[model samples]
Target: MADDAPRRDAALVALDWGTTTFRAWLLDGTGSVLDSVRTADGALTVSERTDSARARAAAFEATFAWLCRPWLDEHPGIPVLCAGMAGSNHGWAEAGYLDVPAELSGLADRLTVVPAGDSVVHIVPGLRDAGPDPDVMRGEEVQLVGALATAADRPETVVLPGTHSKWVRLDGDRVTGFTTAMTGELYGLLMRDSILARLATGEVGPKASAAFARGLEAEAAHGDERGLSALLFTARPLVLAGRLGSAEVADYVSGLLIGAEVRHALRGDPAAVVALCGPPSTEDRYRLALERGGVSVRIVEEDAAVHGLWRIALDAGLASLTPTATPASVLTAEEQPS
Candidate 1:
């Protein structure tokens, strides 16, 4: 395809509108990105501004119009598919959840369409594990579907490490069940507000250092999840005793948390090859811990948000509904940062 082609030729717009971040991609057929945009106008900000249901909906609609104006204007009448918190109860529209053991193929059938001026918007539903213990997830389900769509082997576990890390399991094409660990969130609390904040003063960057390796060793030696409370306290004591440096405390604490998370998640199957997805730095931490635990890792570098939306759009039959042309000329709206 020619690079100068009009935006009207876009296959569709893929949106990953989450709680704290909003990302959109203008894609052509075969799922190649023609253009992309990202903003901080996440659901949290939009939801906080409104009081009533009517006001909330209006707020969401207005936010969407502003965030997506340039792309929507460029590609008039194009279909838009979104996956994430944007479909949550607090978001633009509640798309609800699909129960576990759910097949990836069935995702499209549950899409909730809401009108957006001349364009059409489809919200992908979240997935739930309605077992003896009930749990729900809004966004990661889409990424799982996107990751597994092309896997050669039937992946048993897929780990998405972030603020709230998710460990998802699959039984063939169906998502069997999953679990979440508040590893990143805990790290934030400890490093930002807790007593350990002083020790984490310097930049640790991405690569794991000697101190990080020691933290992993400490976790391995501790060998019990219940002992994390005691382990966390070591950060201060080690620094006070001059056993661990103040600067290295940051990476050390990261290693400790990630190591603990990896051990807990793989408690069922230590040898399982886990598929990981996230930003490079975050995933690198998880990979270090997983490797230390003797678990193999596969980093999925593809844009899961885009791929997932595109796949679900195909399932919803909206990909075929994109108009070839619209009479209105593209609006020259200057893109604004959120």
Candidate 2:
């Protein structure tokens, strides 16, 4: 009788198809990841690398098949659930955007399915903020769905840190609104092109926690009329005056930028509970920034994309047609592996 229990087999393929990378995860009914795949076959790659109009039009499908060839050969006709830029206007196909203040369950209904040979591919739509100042997010919304679904508390702030960091406001299991900060992109420009570039040299590896802390403190205590622009000049002068050194400039700049973002996001209420998502490498830096601003942060695993795709697949009834899960199995790709 005990043996009669239904066996769980690998059910579906969860794909987080971004602008520069394509990541896949094999998941079971219980939402456990079985195996995974990652490739540089992203939306831009397909658009720029392919030759000819026919090839370019079929770029998404062709690149997908090439990357998942091995998996397709092994698993056969498993349904693929994709999220991120793959559904953007610049990707395989445009899935449009669902307005903010939307629920996770409703996201399934808006999925765009593209017939790809034997296996079907489903793309999750992005979210739009229909406010006075309009804004939109393509992929992070999927991760937001997954993060909110697993959270124990309601109405928590979720921060997805990257080239353009997103500060999302979740309320009653719905993503109410969000704001973006160009922290990472600015950091790159400063380190590569700005005056800070002169001294912010050397192999910048693991975060200089102490220097980062200093930056956070300085950013937090900054009381100036010029805002960040005025604050940035201090970096070079501190080095020349021996107040700050050359080697620590990068980390300090990172802290300053991240700290400024945190300070701005948590303005008016600094003690808010925040959930930090995305790559772990930047999580600690963000976590430190938030803490320095008197905010409490909970680090969410980077695999929220996998869970989000699975949940949407289930909601869209795509999971029902896929295979079943097999006992517990786990495999992972290093988040943002260098």
Candidate 3:
């Protein structure tokens, strides 16, 4: 079988390539998952050993090979679509960002090809804000599309939280702009690495204590722009007062990180509803804080990557999500930054 030879596009694959983990999902024509796998084969993970880009791509290919062997034994060839850091500046190859203030529909049919096991693999490029407060995303654009695809109505602001959190504002379906928040890493370090580590020893449970609420209060006062020291102060103040327990302090620390997001980086249209489409735990914390702050919000779904990839794969013509293809809409006139 040749690398570029056409085969029956019966199955679709989606890759959520990240900095540390490479996750792959097999999907049927209707965007349902058939199989999912993760490997220690991310960009930085692969970079530790080899200097060749081709070798790193091979690592991804080999990982996919193991998963697709059975499927290929029957079909011979299948198309895989990827999104996220896998297409970053240092990933397999650069698939550069599409300009932002664009709509979710803009990414519908877009695709980028990468080397795979004698088959075609497409990596989805992230969209970056072109105006001031420049921000970039490699894979979340498709996820955002999934969020909108099943949304109640056009969203005003969509917050996707992780290692690098994003607050994306949309004008109807087209994304107007966004900002990145380092909430995930900051929360992890402050809880485990910093002196604040003394407050907690392990994972936080479902029922967060009063310290969490207190931290949320202080963080709400300062919001996203507040410095690290100030946010951590809530932990110090509570513990010193003999109020927050070692375990309770962990919740406080968690709340501090999320509260800051609610306080800052969430400036969307006053009327736009907030869409929480990431981790449920963080979404829970964000919801409480934002509601308290008088922001109208909704929790869209748990696994945005899968939903986003589903829509992306279908649009890229890899998956049979749609039967009769519709032409891409003429882009709404681009908006100039003030």
Candidate 4:
């Protein structure tokens, strides 16, 4: 007689679907990544291609199926969990929000399920700060969960840098409140459409680090008194006066924007230590600014999304730690199970 048991170890399909990017990972029972994929099929892109809500949902479903076809075919009925704009009002399905003072552990229970072919995809809920100054975040919450899991000591503050930088305050596992700043968006505007763009000749190079430091110093000196508008205009004069190179304009602008954001964020919520969660590019800049502000920084990997999704899967009873088998194609020769 021949043995007829399951041979695949892939337990869950983790997705970090955002505004302009879609990333997925194949995780085994132990939360180790077996394979991964990334693309530009974001929720916004999918929605823009369809008009009606019904059509949009179908498109999202089709996109998910197409992206994870290989994994799904190899491991039928594998649990799928998604975090980010995919659960927003205009995305696949509105997963809703867990208002501030919300506990992170409760996230798994509030998931919204969307049926895609033979798989049921669970979407995580966004966080809402419904105070005098309102703010909302979709995908950063999962990063927070993963950051906390990997931290030796709990950080009072967690900053997620992106187009809209988020300053999140955590009291244990519960989120008390949070704020958002348009630092990255401002950098994009100034480097692309503003007057600074005309003078920006090439990519930010090694020499741009000095220019970036100058921008940080400039912002630190006059940002509070003269305001960002006045300080931003000085970039043009610096270039014309031969003080700043045309290629360095982008880095200088980035420094000014990130400087102001870090300064003000600290003033609002003073923290002795902050856990910075973002990609290497933004992480290096933020680490510089935060250290300059006299705050110790703890760095978390950008791939926190996969760990976060795995945690939620276990909490939701969607995954287990029991060793399992996975398709031979999904694993390298060294990763093959006995």
List all candidate RMSDs to the true structure. Answer: 8.0, 7.6, 10.0, 5.2
Q: What is the lDDT of candidate 3?
A: 0.72
Q: How close to the true structure is residue 336 of candidate 2, measured as C-alpha lDDT?
A: 29
Tens digit of per-residue lDDT, candidate 4, span 173-205: 999999999887788778888888999987554
| lDDT-based ranking | 4, 1, 2, 3
Better of 2 and 3 by lDDT: 2
Give the TM-score of each candidate.
0.87, 0.84, 0.83, 0.90
Best-performing candidate as measured by TM-score: 4
Output the better candidate (2/4) by TM-score.
4
Clashes of each: 0, 5, 3, 5
Model 1 C-alpha lDDT per residue in residues 1-338, reported as the tens digit of each score: 46645454678888888777888898886666888888888888889978877787788778888887988888798888888888988888899999988887888999899887777789899988888878878888778877876566767888887667888888887888888888877987888898899777775577778888888888888948548778888989899999989999988888788888888777864546888877776867778888877888888865776777777887788885444443234533443223
Which number leads on lDDT?
A: 4
| lDDT at position 113, candidate 2 | 82
- On a 0 to 1 TM-score scale, where does candidate 2 land against the true structure? 0.84
Q: Each model's C-alpha lDDT?
A: 0.81, 0.79, 0.72, 0.89
Per-residue lDDT for 205-288 in model 3, tens only?
A: 554446667777777667546674676876776677887777677788877777766665544334336888876666666777
After the best TM-score superposition of candidate 3, give how far the Cα of residue 139 lies from its true spot, in angstroms.
1.6
Worst 10 residues of 2 by lDDT: 328-337
Task: Looking at model 3, report the run of 10 residues with the lowest lDDT sum.
Answer: 322-331
Order of candidate numbers by TM-score, starting with the best: 4, 1, 2, 3
TM-score of 4: 0.90
